[model samples]
Target: MKKPMKAALLSAFIFPGVGHFLLKKYIPGVILAGAAFAGLYFLIAKSVETALQITEKIQSGEIQFDAATISELVSGQTAGAESQLLDIALAVLLVSWLIGIADSYRVGRAQDKNVDASD
Candidate 1:
């Protein structure tokens, strides 16, 4: 397969910055990987916080230990500023992933062209 396609596939299937790393584009690879990881961290943190809150409520008898109630609580928690932050985190993750794939492919293609020209 072509270098560009290979790079794109690596980014898409492995991780957001894997392709850049493969292409020896260390700076972009680090940036993309960092952003993706930051987004994931925020998402996981929010989930854990929500779970703790629900658990506390359940333990306190404020909410029943049922699927419906838990679901409702989870939905309720995702509102206002918190929800907005979560949305932003999700967007960042997605955008970073996409940019990583496209930019890596472009860089790889350019490198391939350079190699061909030099040959």
Candidate 2:
């Protein structure tokens, strides 16, 4: 892989999709970056926190989000596939970043060439 590709991949890996921004695919990269930091990701993280608390409660024989105790606060009835949606969105975001890395790699490779000075 070219330097630019490596740089872009490194940035995307380090910054969660900023590599695409480096490639001038601003809209997509930004959109993905934003989504990565917001919405469903946030929600699932919250769910994890909630689950943890519930687990603590379970140690006391009083779980909350447990299936038999209080049930999932965000369920299929309450939030249909929202978590799944986030997973898919992140997958797409990752893909876009990868494509950006490839493009940037190509760009870097191009930059290393000695163009004919005739023009």
Candidate 3:
């Protein structure tokens, strides 16, 4: 496979920045990877926190956990600041992943051109 496609596929299939790292673009790779990880971490943390809060409310009889009340309870549980953070984290992760794929492909193409030019 061509370097550009290979790099793009790596970044798309693997975590963001793997392709850049393979191309020896350490700074971009590290930044993309770090942002992705941070977004994921925040998402997981907020999800867990929301889940725990819901569980606590259910356990204490403040919110009933039944088919009729499930929707209401779940919505209410996630209707606070944490939900907004989760949304932002999701957006950031998605954007970073896309940028990483495009960047890695561009870098790979540049490297390929350099190789050809020197031939």
lDDT of 2 by residue, 7-104 (tens): 56755566544665565556756665675556446556656876676667767876444564456533432345765765676676566555545655
Clash pairs, model 1 backbone: none
- The TM-score that candidate 3 achieves is 0.85
lDDT values for all models: 0.94, 0.57, 0.88
Candidate 3 lDDT tens digits, 1-119: 99888888998999899999899999999999999989999988876877788778789998777866766665776656767877999998999999999999999999999999999
Name the regions of candidate 3 deviating beyond 4 angstroms.
none
- Candidate 1 residues lying further than 4 Å off, grouped into runs, are none
Q: Clash pairs of candidate 2?
A: none
Worst 10 residues of 1 by lDDT: 72-81
Top-scoring candidate (lDDT): 1
Model 3, position 6, has a per-residue lDDT of 87
Residue 93, model 2: Cα distance from true site in angstroms: 4.1
The residue-level lDDT of candidate 3 at 63 comes to 72
Error of 1 at 66 (Å): 1.1
Model 2 ranges with Cα > 4 A deviation? 20-32, 43-47, 63-80, 110-119
